[model samples]
Target: MDSKIKISITNFITVIYLFCFLIISNGTYISTAAKIFFSILVFFSMIINYKKVFNAFSLWLVIYTLFVLSSVSWALYGEFARQSASTVVYTTICSLAIPLLLINNKKDLEFFYKIIIVLPLIYYIYYLIFYDVPNIFDLRQDASNQIYNNIGLYAAYSFLFVMIYQAEREKRNIYYDVFFVIDLFLIIISQSRKSFIYIGIIVILSMILESKNVLKTLLRILLVFVLLFIAYQVVKNGLFGDSMKELLLSFEGDASDSSYVGRMNQFDISIGLFNQNRFLGLGIGAIEYVCRFVHGQSAPIVDNDYLDILSDLGIIGMVIYYGFHIYLLIQYIYNKKKWNKKNLLFFVLLIMLFIQGFLIRGYFNNYYIPILLYLIYYDTKTLKQDDSTILET
Candidate 1:
């Protein structure tokens, strides 16, 4: 195969998926359409590029596939499970498509970074000028709380994109550093506790990684204080508006007012459900009915991804869910002495995924999980060989 053709096809597919993820941030119709197209792209890419098959079939990915199948098989209502299972299908396709289609070289990874950062900057601009303000502009009717969620997730994506890119390039470009700061700002403005926690963990772990000396450790401690003080001022100043405050504070409210407590109750039920089906799980989408019944009225969906998987997929599903994390930790340890820079980058990503999963019910989202997985896969692929630095450019 000609290198030019391969690069072109890879770049085109990469752009398409990045565009799809951005549009997904805006609404559901585009997201659904993008998922379908992306699936076709993955299948075609797989068939045409059979040599790349191994990239798609990591132990982690297989475990995830098994969990998906088990979820569908054990589903209390196959119809509802089928709908939820679409996420599983789309996720599998995207995960395979990533290492197959993207990260051919360091250059490709670098291009990926540019796209992730630039596109969301455009989206954030639109959000601020349009969605953030009322009467001045109106967003699509479907762009509601869900859109805000997409905003937070994409913002986190941008942060990780910058982190990995900066680490690999081994230079602190002012533009990317500024973008990281802005990413944190956007996260805070979004008033998403999950987002805050996502970056917070990254900062903490990065400090730990970089803190070889006592002075560096102290500086990191000071940095944390500064960040916390700034956050307190931001919240106290009411920068994110009443709705954001209410959402954040909902975590501490009483049983009557606590949406957070509802998720806790659901978590307890999920544990009970997991006990009943320790291995196979109740199957995906089984717990929505359970949640509905428990709440009496329709329970607003929970965001604790781990609990959701626990109740629906059980312990086996949890293993599948965490397979990538396990693989990543092992990979990091193996490469620890060779590349401190890449190790730190992987550490940031691992912490972000762990924190975000716990803080939000994000494990089953059709968009972000695959993106995170692909990012890790590509990072591993690139870091495995120093010569493949095309993406770093």
Candidate 2:
């Protein structure tokens, strides 16, 4: 095969892997599909492009190893352990695949970005127009699927990337701008306050750190605040429907509400679990086990990431996970000294993501973290700006 053809094939695989990850049914089968495709692509790319592995191994290979080990050791339930191991390996492959198999040059980055930039926004729009109730885009308070929030996260990330591309090229694509508006509108409508807050932080930090155009940044900030105010008014006032209005206002509306009290009560119970197993934790999968045992249920419905980690992996997992963030911070700080503007903006965006991971429950979930890990690895290794370099397949 021609070298360019081979590279294009690999790039296509990378894009497919991402698409499958983000757009598939969020079905049990979807993850199996991702796992299979990622495994094949990563192995094929590794064998073909053996050299990049050594070059980029310093960035992510070790982290992958540690995560695998920890997940294996911590997962107490047999099934959960197996699933956790599967998830960790899948993510590791995806994290390494981009830099190793595809994205060897600027064109590769653009190619990858072009695909990524739109799908997430489209997914959000689909929900906004179709699945969502008339005029309401937010997920309900009881929403627990990792996929929904991951779409929002993906949208936020894509918007930030679009902004960077716009700033860098001194141009604006109306499509990206439209996606941004739709994404924000959907976020508010979905009533996912965490997504909005995380995006807000990233935007503010990026504006402060990267954009030289202060007036533009200020205008953007003003616009966001105004939109947020409008969303709050609309949601709080129940403009969409009584159920959604009640849902949005539920967080602050009633102390006696069962959902509100239940989460608070669960947190209190988790606090006791944490106190008992402060360091080693209850063992991997222990929370689910305990929940099942206590509630006579098959799975623990724990939504808080902090409590989940503490209960399942104990303090050991917490330390290593947070340590990973510290390492990422060091990488960003080091890069800032050398300072590529796009990279700096990415670092700013990631910092918010890391913070949000702790503050929100979705961070530890397999869907979004792997993508974030892939970006970090890619940023760490990609240096040259050439657009035509063929990737290895």
Candidate 3:
């Protein structure tokens, strides 16, 4: 294939993948079909790149996905379970396959970075014009509810890659600067507390890893916190009015927060259910079926990712899932000398992902996990060359 053609093809498929992940979800028939189609293409691509992309991490993911699918056999709500299981499988493939097989060079990676940041804003515009969502621009109370939580998290994820992209290059670009501001605004309006906290921690850690001067880094960190403090006071004072305060104050981890309550409620329900199925789980989708179909709540019922894995996949399943994580950690520590900003940040992401998993679900479908997995098997010798060349290209 011609170089441009290959790039275009990959870009097309990737945009479809991102569209499914960020804009629409499996809940809708059209999006469900799109996800399935994207997953099929990813599956074929993974097979084609089997020699290069296939590894223990990828294999572990395949196994975990298969295990989830297998649970459909014993699921109480078998049809719903299969549909739910298929969604997980499809998303897992879409997320993992991108980093593993599609992202082949600096250009592809950069293209992906742009897609992650831009697509959701496009969707938000579409939604704004069409839907009855609150005026997020007006910054009214409950503005964040204008979009689904996961949809808003798309902005958070986009900002994540933006930071990573900037971290990779020594010379910062105004290109990323624009998106940096946009992403922060989107995150703020999303009212996702975990998104704010997660990005803060990750950004600081990446700066620490990539920093050459401790004093400079410390000053920068202090500056960040100072700005945050100012922002806090502004919101607390209702400088924009009580409604604006309500909109932004969702940043705090109030015990009575609905998202927190959803997590705890799901955790409690998961524990109660897990006690019954101590080994293999009640079968994939069983929990979602009970919660959404039976009880009419948000599907998956378990809002916590770790608990989601434990509750749906069970003890045996968690082992298969975390085993890949453990392998990556061991490799990162064992090859400390080879560590650089990219891989080191990936390691940090993995750890923070675990922490984030406690608060949010869907780590299985996060594109970053497979990228981290790819880094684990990535050649150390090439890391130096790739690091330099990425900037040049």
Candidate 4:
């Protein structure tokens, strides 16, 4: 293939991968068609690069894939097991195969980041036009609405990448600052409370990472809090004050709240399920059946990723699942000499994703695994280049 053709094909694949994140299944033919298209693109890409594909596969990925595939034997629900296995395979291809094969240079990486950021900006505009903008003071807005609120989270995640990229290049400017504020606004309006908190923490960490002057950074943070306080007061007494009161009251409500109580019950059920099947647990797709039949609940998956893994995969499974991530963190730390603003941002993002996993099912989230793989590829590529340089010397 011509070099130009290869670049075009790789870029096309990158766009398709990003598009997969934007897909929202609405139980329509169009949604189904979109998913099919994405799968075909991924499958085609894998076939084209079959020889080099395994180069991207790490020991952890291999083990996790085997574990998921093996779950079929012990899975309580045959269909769910098959579906779960398929999902794992698909996600693996998207997160590892496509990027590893296509993204050969920094330009490719930047292009991926650009698409991820722009897509979320488009989503933010869509939300502003279609959805009722939640007043800042109004707390009554549903923060847990994953469907629409997730767009904001996605946007925030992408925005963080863009900022990190800029910081890495020493190119931070007004545009990034503007987008940062816009991203924060969108996150607040989306009412994804956990995401809101995560984004805030990421923003603070990014500021600290990028700042050369510690005292100035501290002053800037203090100013930020002061401004936030002023904004809070203004919104508190504004037209949305009543709605904000309702929201605050909801938070103040204790564990008796249905959502809280339900989650607690789920934790108990997951623990019980793990105890029952100590070795392998219920298998990949057994959560739904276990929840419905054993616990008399409608939810198939729990909100907590750790608990879900424990219930479905068991103690050994948990070790494999979390152990892989812990290993990655260790690797990043070991390579501290290679650390830059960009790598620091990746580390912080990984930490944020790990924290989010405790509150929500974020372990294998679309962005999380891909980011990890990208970092691994980067490290490997850099090491090879260094070795080549040493040989030349």
Candidate 5:
């Protein structure tokens, strides 16, 4: 194939993949169908680029997949176990296969970054015009929580991409700055505390990684916060102010907050389940059944990803599961040669994913695929020469 045609084909497929992911994140009616279609597409991509995909596959990923699949033998709910295993397979294809096959160079990566960043801005504009503006003062509806959460998550990603782009291009574009501010606004309005925290952590990490002078960076950040505070004072009497207040008050609530307390209980139950099982575990997809049978209504869900693995796959599973992430982190750190934008972006992403794992089940989440793709894409590019030499040897 001609190089241009190949690039065009890859870009088209990437667009489709992004669109399907957007639908999945937003909980659209056709999300499941989209997932199935995209999964098929990913499968085809894997077959078409089997050599590259095989070369990129790490030992840890193979081990992790086998362990998850093994859970089916001991899974209490066979159907759920099957679904869980299928999710693992789908995630592997999307995260590992697609990037290795389609995104082979810098141009492909830049194109991917641009689309991913713009996606959240588009979604935010739609929500602002159709939903948020009309119901600015109304309490946030439960049904809309997922939409808000998705927006916040996307916005966080947009921030990271914008920062990376700015750093790489060495240009201070006002448009990216505006987009980042919008992202912060969306995160605040969405009241996704975890997303807010993740963004803050990402920003701090980005500054540290990108800055030459740590003291100067800290001062600049302080100044930005001061400006934000002043802006808040000016808007404190309006609808936005009320929303901000509500968000702040959310953190002050007592123990009666079932959502907060429930998560804690779930963690406790996960530990107990791990203690009882200790080795292989009750199996993946066994959480709901175990919670209902063993703990009754006290612990119905495992929200933390680490805890979920501990309870489902036990000690062995947890080691494999977390060990993969640890290995990746070490690899990125060890490979750090320059304080370039790509390196900074990779560090920020690594920190965000690591922190997010504790707050939610990061393994099979929608964001997981994109994070892994970014990691793998950069890893390949950074180590291309080393990889080739090793293969030649």
Candidate 6:
């Protein structure tokens, strides 16, 4: 195939699967068909790039999925376990692997990352066109007129992506300005508290990583809190409305409030369940078991991804599940030897996926695939060819 045609074909197939993922959970005809179809496309990509098939990173992906699948033997809900296995397979092969093989250079990385960053804005556009925008605008509906936190969470970090892009470039340009604004607008309209805090963390991390002066970074951190105070005092009511304001203040309430305690009781239950099967785990989506057998709820539906992964997958699963991320982190650090943008970028992503509520429960998908793709893409494209620079202008 001609180089130009090959690039176009690769990108086209990738876009199809990417869109498939955005709707893969709908349980609709299109959703089911798209997943199966795009999964086949993923296979085709793998077959065509068979030399990269056994790449160490790619093998780890398969191993990770197999472990998730293995949990079905002990899964509390076999169907959910199958679904979890299916998700890992789909995400691994389609989202992570295909993109990994396709992105062979800095140009590919920039284009792919740009699309990932813009996806949230595109989804927002779709929601505005299709959903009840008035209710969402007034905070009557879920933020972004969608039940999931996908838009806000992804959008918040898209700003950080802009910084990553900046790292790739010699200088900032108008694309940075436009994307920063679009990312901020999407995050704000979604009113996701996690997203809000994610942005704050990104800002602080950027200051700390990019600057050498300790005093300047500390002052920037302090200035962040000052600006935060102003936003709390004035911006919430005007921009996000009363509902969001109430949510913002929800944290300041008594920690022992019944609502808060009720929410955390599940976590307590999760810990107990983990102890029971600490080594092998209860299976993926084990929290649903926690919710059902223990709490009588319909689903696991917890916000904490770490607990969700730990309780369901257990110690062995934890090592495999997190092992891939650790692998990527080590690869990037080895390839890029500085306290670079990619280091802090990956750190923020790990924290979000680890400790925070970047949940699978209310998301189209987790950001894991994108992060994996990024880490691998950087390593493969720029691996220790001395004096090599970052992304193309």
TM-score of each candidate structure, all chains considered together: 0.81, 0.74, 0.77, 0.76, 0.78, 0.82
Off by over 4 Å in 1: 1-9, 25-29, 56-59, 125-143, 170-172, 222-257, 292-300, 381-393
What lDDT tens digits, residue by residue, belong to model 4 across residues 263-316? 777888888878878878778857657777767885655778888887778878
> What tens-digit string does per-residue lDDT give for candidate 5 at 147-232?
67667777887877777766556456666677787777777666565666677677666655555676877876886687566645
Q: How well is each residue in 30-132 modelled by candidate 2, as lDDT tens digits?
A: 6677777777877887788777777433244455346545656644465766665555556566667666666677667766666666767666655555453
Clash number for candidate 1: 12
lDDT of 6 by residue, 294-370 (tens): 67854445665566667788888778766766766676556544434555566555555544544444211453454
Residue 159 CA error for candidate 4 (Å)? 3.1
> Model 3: per-residue lDDT, tens digit, 1-393?
113434487788777666665566447886778767766777677677666446575677778888888888876577877877776677677666665556777677767666766765776676677566765664334553435344446666666666666766778776666776776676665555566667766766666556557797787788778867886797679663454355455546445445445655666777776777778877776666667766676645575766766667788888888787777667666665566555666666766766766765554455545554554444333444443333110
| Residue 44, model 6, lDDT | 75
Please list the residue runs of candidate 5 whose C-alpha ends up more than 4 Å from where it truly belongs after superposition: 1-7, 25-29, 55-60, 125-145, 170-172, 210-253, 291-300, 365-367, 376-380, 383-393
Please give the lDDT score at residue 120 for candidate 1: 53
Worst 10 residues of 5 by lDDT: 384-393
Sort by TM-score, best first. Answer: 6, 1, 5, 3, 4, 2
Of 2 and 3, which scores higher on lDDT?
3
lDDT (tens digit, per residue) of candidate 1 on 81-102? 7877776666667667677777
How does residue 54 of candidate 5 score in lDDT?
A: 52
Give the Å shift of residue 393 in candidate 2: 42
The lDDT per prediction is 0.66, 0.61, 0.64, 0.62, 0.65, 0.63
Candidate 3 accuracy as TM-score: 0.77
After superposition, the stretches of candidate 4 with alpha carbons farther than 4 Å from their true spots are 1-9, 26-48, 56-59, 100-102, 126-145, 207-253, 292-299, 363-393
Instruction: Summing lDDT over every window of 10 consecutive residues in candidate 6, give the lowest-scoring window.
Output: 358-367
RMSD of 3: 5.1
The lDDT of model 6 is 0.63
Number of the predicted model whose lDDT against the real structure is largest: 1
Alpha-carbon runs more than 4 Å astray in model 6: 1-7, 23-25, 139-145, 228-240, 255-262, 292-294, 331-351, 355-383, 386-393
